[model samples]
Target: MQNQSFLAMEDPLDALCHHFSLTKALLPPNARIPPTFDMTLSAPPSRQPTHLFAILPPEDNARVPTLMIPVSAGLYGQSFAADLLPAGTALPVPHIQNGNGAQPPCVTLPVVPVSAPHSLSIPLVLLFGLGLETDRNLLAQRMLPAQVIGEFPHFPAMVGVMAKLPEQQFEWYLGYTHGMWKNVLALAPKDAGLVEFVQMAHKVIVEAGRLRGRR
Candidate 1:
């Protein structure tokens, strides 16, 4: 009997790819892989140190830490600023320091800023909520990409596209993983290694689609 169950589902990207046997054909050539880049999003490359800075706690004795997420230099910067940042500002979060010798009850760190080619526009910053004094070790490892994806809509959707490929299509699989890494890095300040990844992955996606079209 034909497998009619999967056809009934709303999202057929994964299932449909599996139903067909074209997964292996879509894999990129091993020699075509870039030497400086790694497909897994496990860690930032040697030169491209990951940018994860602690954002000040919102409330007194709060138990969370918010971090900065930057964007790339492009025309879309304004769109990002207008869509995300709070009103009347270039930088979304303001500096927080107590007048007295003691620490302020709440701290607000500046949102990650980008020097794009775009014109002056409203401020754009996104503040993530993290409780105070959390363990750095625990947070880094325990936090799933899904959790981070939940917080930000932009990269998640792009990553969603890559997730549709079958397991045998290692090329596309790597592309998907690396694409997500590039997407995350694009949001942060310019890192040379990451910049390389973004350019390469963008080309990979475009080329992959072309290959699929010709087949």
Candidate 2:
């Protein structure tokens, strides 16, 4: 489709809705943009500079920032405990007894508490990772409470870039605002809509960063 055709369309949302052959009922209420958060796995400080915008309040100034841990093994164990393990055997060694009478490897996680409507409780992505077993297990039962709407089990490496923000938001920018304009400039269509999208992404990054700063 040409840019002119898109511009000619009366409503961008309507145009998109029509393109997707979607019904009005299928659309989100008020066409709202969803909240975002970073879920990259816990990594060293060097990986954090890129996602400064993604940090939330309370977490913003964390001298020792929270690490994103990919709980791939943990998630798998939780999701399919019975099928993978022998009868009466539990894959989560500490939690269950293996039918073979052997203890499977287990990792302890840390738990942290958050107050309601608190800064860090704001919805965003969260990733899990495996680290050396420590007396301080940071793994909480739920990464966040029910109120938050972020994705879980995200990959850790993406922390250097977008981390846990919506994948759509991830693609719209480059490393940071410095690369924001250049990234958009390389778009294939080079249309006004594309420009608008990139600008929105840039705004989100700035806004999210500012929000973190406030906390």
Candidate 3:
């Protein structure tokens, strides 16, 4: 319950794991840190700064980012024959690459709030935010194997930031974005464990997908 007890922890993350009273959350990837959101899917995704870390929930794994969760993801960027998509299908969810990451992307998820036994015992806390930014970048199914991203419907949408707070509703542009860290120290060291980080990232993805508009 005190920093004194956490001082003996060999790994800060382990201490984090201990603080959370978790078992499977150990050895998380990226030390439970999200990508710096610097450049887009392109460029190097350097590690950013943070004050919190969490384990990925069982709902997701490495290859599967979103577990078929549905959300009101605004309007469709493109139009496709209803038969091709047939609802509840895997989507190559487009990642919009525009401005440098400077603010948290605004988004929402449907999470059943739970009471944390160690909520008060844990010595640290972290808040997470996500953006619902997607590229109207279209890919037509009719094109088949030839045209990788044959144009579909194009909806011009900008990336916005939404953050998670204790007992609060998600609002857009309510958080900070990447390259925005000013005073916060890096939660994980340079050689932080990747296993736990990946696991933690899985949690973020799952949270973001909580309201996924489509598959």
Candidate 4:
């Protein structure tokens, strides 16, 4: 059934491939598999050193510990890190002083302004939440990537996808586990392929919910 779905939606599958390539090119050189952290479609964990690359809502700035690196709008009418930062540019790392006056542990993270030619040497948690709305722009302005919407329409969607694939494959191929698939579901236009994908994902989410209840 999964094979048939993949075969039937050849165009969307191809679009997925293209999206993956385009998104990967924007990742920092030192970007590695981020540590396991709890996340959801509406809310991300507040305390963890998680890296997010989504168009976040304004409130997220306070909820999540993130350093904003504003960039020029991309040709696709979206803002991306690669467009703003030059290749091989050194990103600024801020040091936080513990209130106890104790020397904080030296933490290494990937630098910002992730350019194409340069590679970040330090391991940083890179959260790829593209299309998340940080500004008060209209709904159309915050449309997320099709891949994100298709695979992770909601938190349950992550659970659904995870149930089907091994951890390694999911992490290596998709980068992040949690997503706002519901957001995408709301914004997506009426297209046969997209609707079919959403339906399949929705079923997976429902089944996952059922299994969770059983547990």
Candidate 5:
């Protein structure tokens, strides 16, 4: 794996051009475009790029900043003001496990409704990273709660795994949603054991759900 992260840190435009085929010539003249790393999730090969606009809150409506998001097919992006989540919702927090003084590996937060008469059709992308063995383990544990919550009505969500290749200096992302896995950018490592990890996650989640139901 070649580290591509350095490319962005050194010359972002060059990185974008090399990776996504985006170029300065594609933009308007005298555009003050800043360097940015495209972290948008992967989409199907047949999909086309789409523009997305943010839905701002009343307080920030006075000075809405120009935002550009590259969206793929079957995806929509929206934003809302921060507010309290519904009562009885479990808030994800870091918990020390096994009394080993080790911090929590992962935290799963609830995707609460932001608008009145909320629609569940909106797909939710859950972002996660794989860097350390602890992270993988934590991801397995956290996935159980994520799957459990996904069963609830009015929440359509999927897991997006972000794998950083320090050697390559770039990132790779894959998504699992609607009963399928999709690669966003580059392919994951053959030895990453992602399939085994996902299988074990599902098994543990099922067993945990069974135990909870027995209670």
Candidate 6:
């Protein structure tokens, strides 16, 4: 059975292509094989979205650590900000409500010179929970300034720094992963490595941040 090369395959991309009978012709330079996942959303075909952008973890079969974002009209960037909305909040538990999600919290700090009685225009509450779950000092000093910077002067996803979030809260927080990617996609060139499995997985995080693969 050692000669049965199929089982010997370690690369998830190769396995995905082999199992799915995919053609690699005309593929980009990396020849990445999209991962296969089983999604059974009750949303009908017509209502189901057709565009998606994903960033996979480095390890093989890295679905568990993958990030998937929705793509609207083949555009996923700052220019497409209107398409990416904060469906809800994700702090203590997943409070996501699609169209009824919470806006960025309206901060009323003690005599702070920031905005007042006003939720942050950016959809950060849905993506990163108002940037106030933990790391009070760091977020106060860093995240808040970018978040309230006028609804998205650019995509404001700070994944590298948010690594300190709790596992479950962080996972649930993925509901807004799209907001993060769209911003990055807007600024990135089409061929600038943000396209495959994707070229910019390092540059963007997924909607759910659950890290699923595609095929």
TM-score for each prediction? Answer: 0.23, 0.20, 0.17, 0.26, 0.22, 0.22
Per-residue lDDT tens digits for candidate 2, residues 92-196, read: 222211223353322222212222122221211111111111111121111211112122233222222333445455333323332433333422222444345
Looking at candidate 1, the ten consecutive residues that score lowest on lDDT are: 119-128
Q: What is the lDDT of residue 60 in candidate 3?
A: 33
**Could you tell me the lDDT of residue 192 within candidate 1?**
44
Query: Which stretches of candidate 1 lie above 4 Å from their native place?
Result: 1-105, 109-190
Per-residue lDDT tens digits for candidate 4, residues 134-184, read: 121111112223333455547565555444654455433232211323422
Against the true structure, candidate 5 reaches a TM-score of 0.22
lDDT of 1 by residue, 29-62 (tens): 2222111111122212111211212222234423
Clashes of each: 10, 18, 30, 11, 7, 16
* Per-residue alpha-carbon lDDT of candidate 5 for residues 1-215, written as tens digits (9 for 90 to 100): 42233131323223322232222112222333343222232222132322221212223233423222222212222221122233432323212122224532221112221221111111111112111122343333333343433443322222111111121221111112212122211112233455455544444333433443454
Clash count in backbone of candidate 1:
10
User: Alpha carbon lDDT of residue 103, candidate 2?
Assistant: 38
Worst 10 residues of 4 by lDDT: 118-127
Quote the positional error of residue 53 for candidate 4 in Å: 13
Of 4 and 5, which scores higher on TM-score? Answer: 4
Question: Top TM-score: which candidate number?
Answer: 4
What is the Å distance of residue 44 in model 4 from its true position? 36
